[model samples]
Target: MKKYLPLIILLFAFIKTNAQYSGALPSYKLVSGNDWAKAKNYYLLTLLQQDAEAAKLLKADAGLAKLTADKIALLKSSLAECKDALCLPAKLKFTDDEINTVAERLAALCKPGSALDKLIKTHIIPSGTYFQFQTLAPAQLLEKAWRQDAAAINHTIAVYAEGAKPNYPQIDSISYNVKKRGYYTLMYDCSAEVNETVNARSLFFEPSLKGALTYLEVNERMQAGDYEPMATTVNKPAADKVKLTKWANYPYTHIVVPGAGPDDPNTPFSGEGMLRCKSAARAYFAGKAPFVVVSGGAVHPFKTKYNEAVEMKKYMIAKLHVPASVIIIEPHARHTTTNLRNDARIAFRYGISFSKPGLIVTDKYQNDFIMNMDKRCLQELGYLPYKLGKRLSDTELEFYPLVNSLQIDLDEPMDP
Candidate 1:
């Protein structure tokens, strides 16, 4: 009981805060399949306390609880399972000519919007961010395992949807507005087995049924690259036309400079913010990058009328005598997470491929911390913020959209 105190308290707080809502799950067709998953999570969470009495109190359905016990043990072993299909197998010919051709071909095929890209993106590419999990499991054993996980996924999604139910005939769009407690539903561990061929389950989504099923088919296709007739290209939008010749102002890939908070009345330019801008300008002049992307909104201490990104760009122009044209200001990100997100949005808008990680320009400590932070920050922001439509760059040019994400929740749940 003591061990479960925090979760118990969190649940109660969640309930109390959301009491204004009807406290009823939405009546979507897929929501009906969520009960078992819900009960199993209750069982597993209670099971973790190691108190048989508390487990009994969860009152999770007998069947679900029993199944959950076995699944929980399996989860532990799954982590150490095979790491196959993660990368391409070794080459057949060591001769430079043959291997290089195959390598180049495979690399081209796996390009951002190639015919054979990573299978996970195929799932969400259909509906952008809104989706529900539907099982397309290959076998009975996997189906059973999936049921347990899906139930948990559905349970969390139901809570989130109920807490902030969208309007009827919900418009298809990405939303990260869900409450903090339901953050677990953001991504499902679709991998029923550790060695599951396609790991699309690791990607984040709204954690609903259709979304889950879309990725299931994607992962299933990963082991054997057989994309069932229309599995990967179902509802994805067409690629944005990119006039690459004139889009970029520079010849080489540039550095991303995410802005820190701005100063207030007493402090004209914050030490932290100035340091970030100065570092970015120094790198720009050092020939490390062709240009610099300075990103941030009017933030810090709130409502003071100082825009972080703009101020940084101004500082760079004044101190380094760097041409103003070399700096791009994204003036709407209020935090470090959005700094990356808005940068991606700006990149996509300008026909830039964010697939290549930029040299993040900031002080050493901030650089380390930003690099270490999980990419799930994208999930928390409710969209990829970069890749969505088909590849815009032409055949001669290669573009890879940023696709790395994690399973963590946000430090600040509300950003809008």
Candidate 2:
């Protein structure tokens, strides 16, 4: 028996690793901290809530039952300063043992690389005082069910309202990879209701102030191109820069160059992005394509003042000596999801049925991601707008109406 101790410990560890946490979690209400802390906790709780709700829905899903069961159990027994309201000590010096002593399994469930941890990585870390987990209810959907029937939602609040301060379903933007249609309005309404009914600040993001928009204000924005007000904030190319020819009778397919990073002042364009732009130029000189579409915005390490497509266009004209007339500037995409979505958006706004999709010219890794999209990508982006093959890898990609037709879901974010 003494000789078998190590093997027994190894077996126990394996079980813990694979074991699903099945804990009954309630709606969390954190005593608000700093902006980063609040935002970080907000998203973390949303992730936890989403999983919790998902576990409930998948109770009968044979494959997921065990995993969901494990999650549920772990959550119910997690160590906390206090069960419902976790109030840290005034000095806030919490050793692992101190935290674990309060609630045995709490820290392990919320540890880094956990499912909950992955979801909240969007936030930048502060000085050691941050943590991150949820399942969503069916009726919580915005478009078909809840938006269609506001009364249904009100009834839920009426039924669940407790002690004049009900635990309502939350609707925070950090929970989603991107916002869907009516997201802002729905959040605005739900948040308003929470404040008015429960006398608490709305956990969800509210788009507008001074009440919901009248019909005219909504129409004015919708009729405009892409309907994103924040596009105006993006840096534009020189006023005199030439626009490319329309899609119809444009002999060759456009080579799409999605922007990579900020341009270096010392050199024209440096970094992996320069390689991507150079790749596009090489394809252009080879006569593989006629036009080039440089798609990117002031993405990452935000407010760097360098537009990826604009810098690429400059590099193309000065370095590669590619014709300026052939390049189309799509200067508002913040992510790859937007990279594909923006191309289709700009195309339709310019022409009716001139061409299908632009041929995407990007790095090998990015091209592979587009080619072999996974579940998380599909869920966040909603669709892959372009068709990809080896011929298109780092050279070209096709755009289809089915994908382009769906709205770019980044309808609203706190930042543009």
Candidate 3:
């Protein structure tokens, strides 16, 4: 009787040890056509904790705990909101992609010294391995495993979205004003032209002749009384014309031109011209207030347009009489949208207030586009103040003609 008792005791101890090694059995059997992926994570985590190494991995830190809880709550809410999509078992099937996604999320949550972290660091599991698990035909086992891990699945989605939200703060408001007579300018590419000039003499002579022709034509028409010199025609007038209304109150003006260098043939006016324009505009509005802004950035590898803002500002200050104190240069903007967004931000930061509308000066063709883009940007940035005004217009031949000539050179090469 004593010997049999010892045998029974030894057997009992062995059974207990085996049970502890396998971990607790999953709470339920895997259901067919049901999403068992999340449950599987629960089971794996439980099983992993059985070993000391796994146990270390399973210990959640405060950051992980808080994040996991928040994520779970969000997922629960999202799931409840999307009951129709989530409730269907068919929609829940564990695909390899889904499993990999969950795994990656889990890995991100794992702490550096944890057992789970070790596993991830050592294992090169492909993203879509969950679907392969289904091939084992252990549906009942998987369902049981997944059921236990339901909480973790919810947490993953919430955490991911939080991390992915746009980090840039949305602009709430932007305001700027000219304290005294000064100028602000916005320029854009309009059209382009090209004329051969052998030297400085030719460059000056040819444009002068063209200007003279334009002036003569205008004077002749005026003398004949063929047309009235209305403000709308002679200078941009206040009308429903989208361009004029856009800049009606924003009296500051700047010039945007194309080409690579300060003296690039594309923008014959050059950097000196930009500075002179700034100084002249500032002097004209003398007591009104003055602030100069230039917007443009470097061209991308595949982009055709050189950054006009940087080039324009550099030339405006270095070659022209414009003081650097009054000039704002935006060198990061790559497109019209960025130009409006970033430039407005700079203005807002500097405490520039706009009691009257602002001014925009660009090539004729770009007049409409810049005006509209500025309006849209202001609206987006939540800085809808006064309408912009068309402060000045340069001759089409000066900038537009040059841009047009370069399109063929700028287009990407076609595959033969």
User: For residues 102-167, what per-residue lDDT tens digits would candidate 2 score against the true structure?
Assistant: 122223333456442343232211111121111222112111211212222222222221111121
- Give the better candidate number (1 or 2) by lDDT: 2
Residue range with the least summed lDDT across 10 consecutive positions in model 2: 124-133
Task: Please tell me which predicted candidate would have the highest TM-score against the true structure.
Answer: 2
Tell me the tens digit of each residue's lDDT in model 3 across 1-416: 99799999988866663343222111112221121221122334423433456443323344334433443333334333433322221222233444444444454545555555443323211111122232222323233223323323322211111111111212111111212222121000000011121112221112212221222222121111111121123111211132232333433333223222243434433444364346444542453235555655443322223445555655666756555555555544444544444444333323243234334444444555654554554443233322444334542111110001100100000100
lDDT of each: 0.39, 0.40, 0.32
What lDDT tens digits, residue by residue, belong to model 1 across residues 1-416?
99999999989966753332112111111111223222212222212133343233223434334333443433334444523311101110012342233234333334444322322123212211121211221122122322334343433333232222322113111133433543223322333422243222221111123332323233221111111111112101111222232324433355667777744544445778777777667666777555577776555643445666667778888986777656666665666666666565444434444434345666666555554444655445444433323221221111222422111112111122
**Residue 379, model 2: Cα distance from true site in angstroms:** 0.8
Q: Scored by Cα lDDT, where does model 1 land?
A: 0.39
Mark the regions of model 3 whose C-alpha exceeds 4 Å error after superposition. 1-288, 300-307, 374-416
User: Model 2 reaches what TM-score against the true structure?
Assistant: 0.41
**How well does each candidate superpose onto the true structure, as a TM-score?**
0.36, 0.41, 0.30
User: What lDDT score is found at residue 33 in candidate 1?
Assistant: 25
